[model samples]
Target: MMVKVDRLSYNFGPHWVLKDISFSLDKGEFLFLTGHSGAGKTTLLRLLYGALPVNRGRAQVAGYELNKLKKRQIPQLRRKVGVVFQDFKILPRRTVFDNVAMALEVRGMPRPHLERRVRAIVRAMGLETKSYSICERLSGGEQQRVAIARSMVANPELILADEPTGNLDFDLTMHLMDIFKQFHTYGTSVIMATHSREVLDCVPEARILHLQDGRIVTDSEPGLEEDVQ
Candidate 1:
């Protein structure tokens, strides 16, 4: 399994954000997290990627025991699990190539290999011409693509994305969806948090986990009628 959660829960001070969530994702499987804002989708993704410490319960992501994971071990876990933030955390001052290449550089990859790998993913994202352009000058959609490219450049075993296509237009959203599907075809496990119906339709094979108040409600409610936005 690429990810496993058993009775997982989290809290923010006195307010509980997640309540006894449980699910497992097999290796090479693609899963979608659908929920309205504040449904705890972002918080759940944060716990899986080690951004937030597991406040309660158990979670194993890309082979790391998250609840027991040490601070020093976070970098190791991250190398095996790629994350695309909802905020697009790429450096604004850095060029597109620099932002994407940073992932491999942190791993001490050789210059020749890093350049080839970064360029390939950049081209896939349709940012080949902007590879040398500063990210601050790019539009929101372009910056979002930069974040996606950076997350995939390292070829991690699992990818966790938070609304990757939120800022893109219909045509660009479909284009980016194709790129995601291509990577899934290569056997990379993916757990994407999204509210777009078009995005869900694009990956009909993916298992949908609808989160309502941090609980998986799809099993009890087979009707699955919440708009998905």
Candidate 2:
């Protein structure tokens, strides 16, 4: 499995955000975290990616024990997980190409290779023309694509997205989901947090895990109910 969580729990000060949550995902599996607001979907993803400490239980990603890995080990772990946020985090002053290429640069990819990889991802995200344009100049959907390009350029084994398609129209939303599906096809495990039933209906084959008030209430995937048991 690419991810494993056992009896995981988290609290934000006086509020218990996640309680006794447990789930696992195999390599290349695509799953959805669906829930209403404040249901802990974001918190769960943060735990899996090691952004937040697993305050009450065990969690592992790509075989690195979250609780045991050292601070220096975090960079290695993050290299295996690509995170896409609902808000585009690209630097407004930088060009699209520069924004996407920053990840490769941080990982110390050589100049020529960084250019090649960033261009490939930008093209894949349908932002080839916008590559040299400043990020602040792009439209909302285009900016979102830049964020996706940045996330995917790393080619991480696990892709974690928080509301990747939250603010787009139907067409753009489908386009983004198709990009995620491409990542899944390339053997990257994908877990996305979304509340839209429309998104679920668009991708009916994806395993759906419903989170309600920090607990998983339903898990549905054709012929996989037995696996859950």
Candidate 2 structure quality by residue, lDDT tens digits, 2-64: 999898889999898898888999999989887789999998998887778876989989999
What does candidate 1's lDDT look like per residue over 28-139, in tens digits? 9889998888999999999999989986899999889998899999999999988888764899999999999999999999999999999999999999999999999999
How accurate locally, in lDDT, is each candidate? 0.90, 0.85
Off by over 4 Å in 1: 219-229
Against the true structure, candidate 1 reaches a TM-score of 0.95
Please give the lDDT score at residue 102 for candidate 1.
96
Which parts of model 2 are misplaced by more than 4 Å? Answer: 222-229
| Candidate 2 TM-score over all chains jointly | 0.92
Q: Which ten residues in a row have the lowest lDDT in candidate 1?
A: 219-228
